[model samples]
Target: MPVVLSLNIAQRTVPVDYAQEGATGIDKRPVDGPLDVRAPGPKGTAGSGVAGDAIADIVHHGGEHQAVYAYAREDLDWWQAELGTDLRNGQFGENLTTSGIDQTHARIGERWRVGTALLEVTAPRIPCRTFAGFLGRTGWVKRFTQVARPGAYFRVREPGTIASSDEITVVHRPEHDVTVELFFRAVLTEPALLPRLLEAGDSVPPEIIDLVHRRTTVQLDS
Candidate 1:
């Protein structure tokens, strides 16, 4: 069974000297015990965020579709090798650092029973300038995009508390061709593949669906 190896949250946003926003909530720290997860509002809009987590940019971060970000320990290990550095849990700004699961391969709309909260996989986290600044890596945005192992975001279906070490069980998986890996690649690399995202129906994150629709509209007009 997959388990939550670390539960993390940040109370205050960290200063990102290079970003125009000046601060970022990407610096998350590990925490003990349980944390509440819930839908604070409409699906596409920002939720209150994890009980103790502070999301700096509401325009781009937060939202019901991205209520919680998750990354696998395995992926982090891979990055560690590439960067030649040690990465602590939550270093990637994920609310949950999970073990024994391939998060990138999780199908869009997949549901997981995490602690007492039920979460549905919605979309993939897209790296940005703030993320690059946080890492202080040169050309980090391009590097991350090319790596294309963007972690998955999930929406809270059943509001409840989740703690470190909680077992994660896949309760449901929709019959869809869109996996998190494919979704990331489509959104960032292959605009033509955007139409393929429609197969997930309403399960695809609304924001991404809108993007694909917009791209399709542009193609038709052109």
Candidate 2:
């Protein structure tokens, strides 16, 4: 049974040189009790879906599409071994630290009933300089991208509260093979896989779809 091992929130922002604002809320920490989840309007305006969580960079983080972020504990464990360091839940800035689920392969548009909130997987977490700076590691973004195990991002379908240990039930899955890993690779690493993203239909972000269309059209014309 897939369950949330930790419900995390950014209680405060931490100063970081990598972020545009010179501070970031990437240092999320686990908290007890139920946390409210909701569609936080749009990017450049909204912040985190989880109550009390912070998003210092409005231009790049948060919004309806990235309401919540979930990282599987298994992936964190893998990173722990790879880096030979201790990684606590929410260390990756994920709102939910999940167990018993493969987030890397979770299909886009897949819906999960977590506690009372219904979440739809929307995208994968793109490695950023803030993440790299938080880890204080060189070439961290490239290393993470190479692994292609980026955790999943979710948009709130039904607003509610979620708590640690809440069971996650897969209530719906789109009939497409566009998993988080596939989407991440398509958008970041493999341009050849761009056309494959079309099979995901509207499950993908409109901007990404547009990118694929433009790229493919340019290729045809050339």
Which candidate gets the maximum TM-score versus the true structure?
Answer: 2
lDDT digits (tens) for residues 1-222 of candidate 1: 799999989878877687667777888999996988888665435644489898777777787778899999999999999999999999999999999988888998899999999998888889888888788898998999898889999888899999999999999988877899889889888877789888877767777788888988898899
Clashing pairs in 2: none
Q: Please provide, for model 2 over 1-222, each residue's C-alpha lDDT reduced to its tens digit, 9 standing for 90 to 100.
A: 999999998999988778879999999999996999999987778898888999999777888878899999999999999999999999999999999999989999999999999999988999999999999999999999999889999989999999999999999988889899999998899989999888877667666789999999999999
Model 1, position 179: C-alpha lDDT score? 92
Collision pairs in model 1: 46-63
lDDT of each: 0.86, 0.91
Error of 1 at 218 (Å): 1.8
- lDDT (C-alpha) at residue 6 in model 1: 96
Give the winner by lDDT.
Answer: 2
